[model samples]
Target chain A: MAKILIVDDDEDFVSAVNLLLKSNGFDVAIANSRQEGMEIFDKDNPDLVLLDVMMDEPDDGFVMAQSLKKKAKNIPILMLTNVGQVTGMDFDKDSEMVPVDDFEQKPIMPNILLEKINQLLGK
Target chain B: MQIIDRQKVNEQIRDLKKKYGDDRSALMPILQDLQEIYEYLPDVVMQETAHSLGIHPVEVEGVASFYSFLRTKEKQGKYVIRLCRTISCDLAGKSNVARQLENEMGIKFGETTKDGKFTLEYTNCLGMCDRGPALMINDRLFAKVDPEKASQIIADCRRDFLKSDFPKVVPSDVKKAGPILDHDLKPAEAIKKALSMSRSEIINTIRESGLKGRGGAGFPTAVKWQLAGAAKGKNKYVVCNADEGEPGTFKDRMLLYEHTDFLLDGMTIGAYAIGASKGFIYLRGEYLYMKKYLEEALENRRSEHLLGKNILGKDGFNFDIRIRMGAGAYVCGEETALIESLEGYRGEPRNRPPFPVDTGFQGNPTIVNNVETFIDSALIIVKGSEWFNIHGTEKSKGMKIFSISGDCERPGIYEFPFGIKVSELLKEVGGEDTKAVQIGGASGHCISQKDFNRTIAFEDIGSGGSIIVFGPDTDMLQVARNFLEFFVEESCGQCTPCRDGNPKLLGGIEMLENGRCSFTYLNELKKLCETIQNASKCGLGQSSPNAFLSIVDNFKPEILGRVPEAD
Candidate 1:
């Protein structure tokens, strides 16, 4: 089983994602804020990360993605956010500002999320 | 006989440090209190303050010299009379009042009377542009002062019988009120409703309302709240930018008075959404008269458990607010500069990228919204986005409060929706025959007659809600000169283009007045305006040349080829 870390402040969304990952045979760990997310990543060493952009800070997910890339280049980051909808600030994956393996909007369809995860994890 | 009690002064300084805290941020209030005691800040007193605050004496001196309100070398007269010298007042014959004051005082402007009874000085806008030739004597405001009234005021001040001449609170004339202004929303009701909703839900509601900043900038308010909420800080802050020093802008003065509760409600709601435990209302020194009224309002909120810790029975949710006074620096109206003033530093704009949301006061996340913006958001919380959104256009949602002045007959506060046209506004305000209109303040565009059809929206001629109408007889060149002079005086002088280029533009206007300006040189000056706009570090500098450029471009036929006057 590929271990996955779900980092978001929205409890309901986090809970739903946690169940989806677990039932699909992926082990899941949860962290609510950017600081907590980093600590959990170090401790758990998850295979993949489910990141949120606006948590305790607006760009926490992007900052975390950069840090994660620096720490473990092999591990993939899948950004799940409502930042574009919320802020109206158009952004996409770029190596410098928004560094991530793949980006998807929040309330992501379960099958699409699993397919993206499998592709990043080389399933 | 000015007596200096060294021991007593030292003890008082120690007490002030305790009252305000021992950090560098406490320097401004402590100095203000000391100035109140001794009339002027003596070197010995400033040195003692430096020692108490644990900052250097030169650092204290730097701050004292920066603000016009803080005096150092000499004692101010018992009455420090600051007469408004900005555009609207200038148009309202402030010079006549200025001459009358000088004749009555037996001293020129900036000089204190020998007996220390009175001092005359020129200040920027006093937020009374509608009633021009207004002057502030100590903490009291006197508006519509004619030559006769000016002399009488001087006599009254001398006899110490000016008590009955002024009202306790200044009255604002609201000529027209829209749904935003005349709503039946009570005090703290929005806050009560905000408390019921989740934090994200509150932010989402604001985002849905399309509420941009009302402080002239029109930046989206929801983005600011969301960013501040997500920002990593031990403490976060929600600041009410009550520094309404924009030359022709005074709607905030009315909002602070008329919509006091709604303003407080919005601020409390902002604090809750951003997770800010503390907030500050950075009130301008010009609006010193409104301070006590606001302080009392804050006290009411605290007593009712609407403001202070664990508000309304919510555990671990605690928030409080304080009022900080700006010492007559117009640039302090800028968000970062206001934060600097709140931190006891000179009101200079800081470089961007690490914006206020990510890093602000005391290196914490902070949101500084205009007074009207806060009230609008709070109203959104109570009434929902649709109630606020039904009126305005697509991009610019909700109504805006305008402080209309200059040649307009009905000069007062008017609330209009976002997409109202200039011509429509003129007809409503009885300024249909007006030659041009200076939309926004000194930093905004001076619109011509042809562009009256342009709507007041983010997509068009956006305003911070200051409308100055120009009559047919009005001198466009003089109008440009007045705005340039305002920028020259009010610029923080941190950047070269703003500090140097503004005076250069003012000199060019003088040449135009004398008809000595050449066509090639005129074009050169126009380029300089663009350079100043592009090169300056902050908004003040960038927008300083706006009025001048607009007038030069719009009224070319009238401005060019002037006959040489008799020297």
Candidate 2:
């Protein structure tokens, strides 16, 4: 089973994701804050990460993402956004949506998300 | 995530002052940094800021909490998600957008998800109105959002945590591809148009267009004109409500900045429409830049004979416009309070029946309207009401301007026809992830993804088009607390619920944060929220509890947490 760490302020979503991933034969750990997320990232050796863009703090996820990048440069960062681009910021390079390994919107679809996870994991 | 100490905050302030000079302008960035470090600026932070900079603590505190960037109170959750709910996004179903994030996250507006990982929030105007339903996940903005996109974004963020290391997503270099509106009509031309337009014709034309007020209440522009015009008085006045205190709504600023002449034209049309001789732009003192531009525009018009005893060589529609500054009071936005301020009284709303239209501005018939309402007059005259009607819904005709700010990619002012879907606007603007869209400023509703199909028309948009979008990462609880803090400060201290209840609401949110409040307390507080909305005298009081109410209704579980700890 692939070891995964989940950092998000939305515990319900985290629980659901944990269940979904665990059922799909993956080990999951959850952190509710930017500080905890980063700490866990350093402590636990997870194969992948699921990060929520906005946490209890507005930029918690971004801060964590930056920290993760600083700690390990090659780890894939899948950014989850609930309200997608309210500011109309286009991150796509050459017409393709900017891919930070992978991206997903909120209210996750279990199967679809699992497929993306598998694809990104290359399992 | 950084535990910023006061020393670090002071040092940052000193550095900012050094870089930007000791001028007051340097404080904004310093306060913003403080908010970033502390999540919200505490009272002590303000005092420290003042002590460090050799300024009065009150001044520092005033400036710190005045702008949306400064947060003086603690929020409910560890993570904060501020979603913009303005008109642009409302027409785009920002409520549904917000709701989708709630459902997906298993949270609600102004509530933390059960695990305390996030807090949802609502922001008034993010200044990116053009891209309806904007959101800001931290300092980064993503424009043009929809429900599905919001879910996808959240999922992607979750995936990042699953990885052992933090997500490594570098923001791309931004490219300014769209046309930036940099041109303004010449004062000479604006004056000429203002002079030529006849009073009766302007009224008739506007009446034909079905234009309504852009402010909270959508009153008919033409009927208001006729009443004001018919009122028996020599001391008639035209007052423009430029004191836009509502959060997430800055179309007025855009108009004052980019289309001052149009406002003048509209006011002139209104002046002619209602036979008012003089007009005052009741401008918010916080909008120093907008006031400066408006003053300059007025000066230009006066120099070119567009304001005083004017003649476009044919018709003599003589009128003048003056700018009045508001002393940073939310109550002044109310017509009665605005009038009281002009009369040198404490800014407070008075009893109605002898509405401003009947006995206003020194006991004369007065016409007060929002800046956007006035701007519509010029457009209605230029293009017939039929043309305006073709764009918007039958009841509310014409395109509305929205300041789209928040997590969206493009944060700017957008003009779109009413009834547009929230999802469609997001897709058009390339919003790949949208959590929720807050419509009608902080007082507006929080929409989820399921309601994306809702149209962005007048009846549905709620008030005017101040649309804010949130990315999937937003925490509703923190956002709600932020708005509650605003209410506590912005309240005029008139009614009990609004004045006294504000602190209580803030306290309730705090209790929620401490993990001490009982579920019964929350339920009671929710009831109080409704009572405040129903009994409060003014609009501000009435809508003060909306942020909390929306959260309680939409995201109850998020607010009450899974733990049953009580104080």
Candidate 3:
């Protein structure tokens, strides 16, 4: 089973995702901020990362994603964002400035997200 | 601790301390060097820096987080594409440029590409307003870039990345016109003239010319010199504030480039007038290309007896200047923050009870004048106050250098007398089919067609010479939002009003843009901006809302496109 790191400030969302991933037989770890996320990422060396666009600040998640990509170039990342709703600017996943394999907007569909995770992890 | 070589890091830190001096003030430069070495400020490096500076780790961390340039992350890409998203560039269709880059590189504004080849990010301004839409790939600037050019630029970067050969892309040719003072004049001519006059006479000439600091704030140059000269201190210093970080303003760059010796001569003259032996030119980091030229000028001056050890061969008038580069902070352009950055601290603005004239650069009496101000002083001394005063209005005397860009046939530098109307300038710069004009970069006023009759004087509509004309199709609300986002990222976060208030204003602007804000909410935001203007610690915070307020005041109908619901 491939291990995945979920780095987000949304506790309820993280718990829900954690339960879903675990039920699907994937190893899961969680971090609430960029610093904490990096620490866990270093420790676990997760095969994939689920990053949020806004954490402590609006661009914190993006900054964190860049750092993570630097550390592990091949580790695929799926970005979580409500940027379109917040700023009325839609972020295209394929044309994102930050390096992210996919984007899952908030109020995520469990099946779609699982499919994306599987696609990114090459499972 | 484990990531870096301990001995090597210690040696580099030691070298930095020795070079910048052993004082705690060297902290900013030291941190900048460490960041250059490590790509970002790691926790271990911060701790070591604190230990080296003999300060607490929190202080180091606090300073590191305060500056926009200093990053604490480890994820910088090979080519960081800093696209200028300020008003001038925005009006010049920077959005299209951004979209093209995003589509080509497969990344959004803040994301690095998958191959670590590119990291697209938005920058406040690269001082190339006359060449917008401008973007910098690393420190190499690419100006006048359209959507097609942006794609080619990115492709060029990818090619360079693959080949490991990164050469600076030559900036597109910017046409120069109008009455630029002393463009072809020799270096030490003004200084020689000033050397013949009494110190008081030089100050009086500047006063008679009615010259003011051209760094946005129209404080009288003569009065500033008088204060510094009269201040009770033996170790007086003259600091030429070459840190021209104002968005859309690059007249200083032109001045420094074309007339390097003229600016240095002016600084030397300032040192003599103020009875100061030491002088420093705080150059901005973005214009690193100008550094070598300036250093070469300084070297020539030293050899010619125009700078060091009794400049111009006069005893008791010894003076010299040294260049100190800024490590990319917009707030450092503020006088107090510049002083703080000079002293090696985070470029945070200090409270103004003891102004820089009284307590500056090592707590000595110092005179901090802008690059244009120094050049104006030199010209005033040589040309006589009466001759210099003949050009401008009653209050705002002397010619001003304007960096005109966007929505024009010919965009570049133009020098005009202060009382010249906006329409007149528009004609000169080919500003046709104009809807609005943003004067003085992000933190200056936005004027509409009705205000074209307004004169460019301190008494009417003053500026630091950044005029960005927008055609009819340009969106005023989007322009305002672009400036607000600039303030959001560049705010030093020292005070509550600025730190918290700017982001709120940005959010409010977004809400309004999306038609989610009510009239009452807009009014509240206006009130909040007033508070921020009055209560913020420094000029950055105080003037941050100028464009927003001006846009709202002028284009209320546009901003209120949606009708307000009754409570």
Overall lDDT per candidate, in order of appearance: 0.88, 0.67, 0.80
TM-score of each: 0.85, 0.56, 0.77
CAPRI verdict on model 1?
incorrect
Candidate 1, DockQ score (0 to 1): 0.08
Report lDDT (Cα) of residue B209, candidate 3.
85
Off by more than 4 A, model 3: A1-123, B113-117, B159-184, B565-567
Best by DockQ: 1
Over B438-491, each residue of candidate 1 has an lDDT whose tens digit, in order, gives 998999999899999999998898899999999999999999998998899888
If both were scored by TM-score, which would come out higher, candidate 1 or candidate 2? 1
Model 2, span A22-43: residue lDDT tens: 8989999889887888888889
| Cα displacement (Å) at residue B73, model 1 | 2.4
Q: How does model 2 score by TM-score?
A: 0.56
lDDT of candidate 2 over B480-502, digit per residue (tens)? 77678778867877688888988
iRMS, model 2 (angstroms): 24.2
Q: TM-score of model 3 relative to the true fold?
A: 0.77
RMSD of 2: 30.1
iRMSD, all candidates: 10.0, 24.2, 23.4
